[model samples]
Target chain A: GQQVMQIPQYQHVQEGEDFTTYCNSSTTLSNIQWYKQRPGGHPVFLIQLVKSGEVKKQKRLTFQFGEAKKNSSLHITATQTTDVGTYFCAGFDAGNNRKLIWGLGTSLAVNP
Target chain B: SQTIHQWPATLVQPVGSPLSLECTVEGTSNPNLYWYRQAAGRGLQLLFYSVGIGQISSEVPQNLSASRPQDRQFILSSKKLLLSDSGFYLCAWSTESYNEQFFGPGTRLTVL
Candidate 1:
């Protein structure tokens, strides 16, 4: 089974601050997907990075897949209160029925 | 827009009680389904996944089980619950050709 480890288990920032979370996997992933879960809410899909070194952005959120395909990052710029939540990175290891290995996640707290 | 539904938005049960949570997908067919659990202050953990009806796969050995009775319906059940089972349970679905998984509103379960 593949394992993905995420760094900075928690983050707190001012409304106009920037934040980022990193995820690393033990094996190369077929693809990586990012998700955000607001407090007391379910996880929601944010974006996916398939190609090596791929980068995608949604409004103020940026996602990046490491060139090695074994790591990824999510960066949020000029964060707001609405950005408070746990950000998780999931990677699929096609080897075992294509099961997903998810990062524990970074819980973000934005102060207004 | 596609919608995924989970019932009993919140539940409270006692030890040894039976547990059941249902999840269903709409606007999609034969999509991959997944069951995950998130403990407070923790990342999401994969419990089970299915690629098709009656093709359930367990990610971890636990007190819970899952079944897919229909093309779009997935169920998570436990005959006897444990205090450790208290957490937020989430269901998700995705296409076979893609890696982005869309999650349903989670069920908050508390074992009292």
Candidate 2:
């Protein structure tokens, strides 16, 4: 069975601070996706990284995929109160293209 | 434009009661549908996925089952509920051409 693990199960930071969450997979992944779920709300798609060693940015957020495709990270710069949410990383198992493994989310709490 | 809908937004049931949750996708045809569960303070867990009507794949063996009666309709059902069934259930959809998944507002279930 494929598994994805995320670090810092919970994080609390000041509004202007930086935050990062790391994700690792037991097996190689064909692609990885990032999602954010606001408190009491549904998860929303953020970005996807496909190529190894790939880095993509969306405004204050930066996402990176490991060269081996077995790990990834999401970094938020100068976090804002509105950025508080649980961040999750999902990976498509290389062995089973149809199966997507989800990491336990990193819950972010930004305080003003 | 695409949207996913799930209902009822929240539910409460006694132990041993039957359960049913519905999810539907709009503005897309023949999309891949998925069901996931998230316990309090945890990450999303893959439950079931359907590639088309009458096609389903179960990711974990639980007291639950899923069905796809229409191209864009997915249902999660259980003969009898347990306390462990209490959690937030989410529905998501993705097109064949893309790997990013769009999620629906989740349903919060509480099995008393």
| Interface RMSD score of candidate 1 | 2.0
- Candidate 2, clashing residue pairs? none
Candidate 2 lDDT tens digits, A3-97: 89999899999999999999999999999999999999888989999999999999999999999999999999999999999999999988788
lDDT of 1 by residue, B29-104 (tens): 8999999998888988889989998999897899999999999999999999999999999999989735688889
Q: Each prediction's Cα lDDT score? A: 0.90, 0.93
Model 2 Cα shift for residue B65 (angstroms):
1.1
Candidate 2 Cα deviation (angstroms), residue B32: 0.7
Q: Which candidate achieves the best DockQ against the true structure?
A: 1
Model 1 chain A: ten consecutive residues of lowest lDDT:
A92-101
The value of fnat for model 2 is 0.67
Clashing pairs in 1: none
TM-score of chain B of each: 0.97, 0.97
In candidate 2, stretches whose alpha carbon ends up further than 4 angstroms from where it belongs are none
Candidate 1 local lDDT, residue A51 = 94
Q: Report the Cα lDDT for residue B99, model 2.
A: 88
